[model samples]
Target: MAEWVPVFRGEELPPGLMRVVTIGDQRILVANVEGTFYAIGAVCTHTEGYLDEGYIEDRTVVCPIHFSRFSLISGEVVEGPAEEPEPTYPVEVRNGIVYVQR
Candidate 1:
């Protein structure tokens, strides 16, 4: 069974920024796109690059190691070097707090 875990305060992550968080044994990459929050696997599928160290362009996140682009919405591989799609988690913001389903 999965439960919603409070990861961070909403104010902690501003627009166009992201951070890596650990919930249980999972390392998740949390991104703030405009005002919406998105959660995905922290590791890049291609080379295990830390996605938090990468940058977001529009709605895609580019890997820092090999520049593989992954969609923030669907976690799909938008560009190559990575054939596998990252796993995405359900994110919700409640009363200025951000939570991720784990």
Candidate 2:
């Protein structure tokens, strides 16, 4: 069964901002693009850098260590040094709260 965990409220993450939260053993990176929310793996596949500490450009999250860019929505490796794509979680806004489907 899939579990939905509430991470934050809709107003907590503004446009072009990223938030990091650890749930159990999973480190989640939540990004706000325009007004939509996207959740992905926090650790960069290149160097284990935190994606939340990196910059947000368009729909891509760049790694702070190696400048590898990953798509926030699809979790694809858009830029290199990181060949593998990160895992992404489905996000849903319900009653003004942001929930991550796991």
Candidate 3:
């Protein structure tokens, strides 16, 4: 099992925002959707599109390069150019701190 690592203070990320964080050589995209936190791979599966450069549409993150829409909840492909799912990390909030587990 992977241990959870503190990524950010809960107040740092408000609702409807996305941030890039690095944890022990792993680059992860942390998204805040109405107070719910989700962490996903920063790299797009189809191409080398940087996910952090993409915009969030509702619960999906659109790839900036090819415009692939990836579900934030399941990391599944909502729209294509990408057939693979993005890897999502487990997230939790405690006492105003956000933690992400690989």
lDDT agreement with native, every candidate: 0.95, 0.93, 0.92
For candidate 3, the TM-score is 0.95
Whole-model alpha-carbon lDDT for candidate 2: 0.93
Candidate 1 similarity to native, TM-score: 0.98
Q: Report model 2's TM-score to 2 decimal places.
A: 0.97
Task: Score residue 77 of candidate 3 by CA lDDT.
Answer: 95
Instruction: Extract clashing residue pairs from model 3.
Output: none
Off by over 4 Å in 3: none
Q: Which is the winner by TM-score between candidate 1 and candidate 3?
A: 1
Query: Which digits, one per residue and each the tens of the lDDT, describe model 1 over residues 1-102?
Result: 989999999999999999999998899999999999999999999999999898999999999999999999999999989999999999999999999998
Q: What's the C-alpha lDDT at position 42 in model 1? A: 95
lDDT of 3 by residue, 4-48 (tens): 999889999889889989988988999999889989888899996
> Once all C-alphas are superposed, what RMSD does model 3 give against the true structure?
0.8
Evaluate model 1: give its lDDT: 0.95
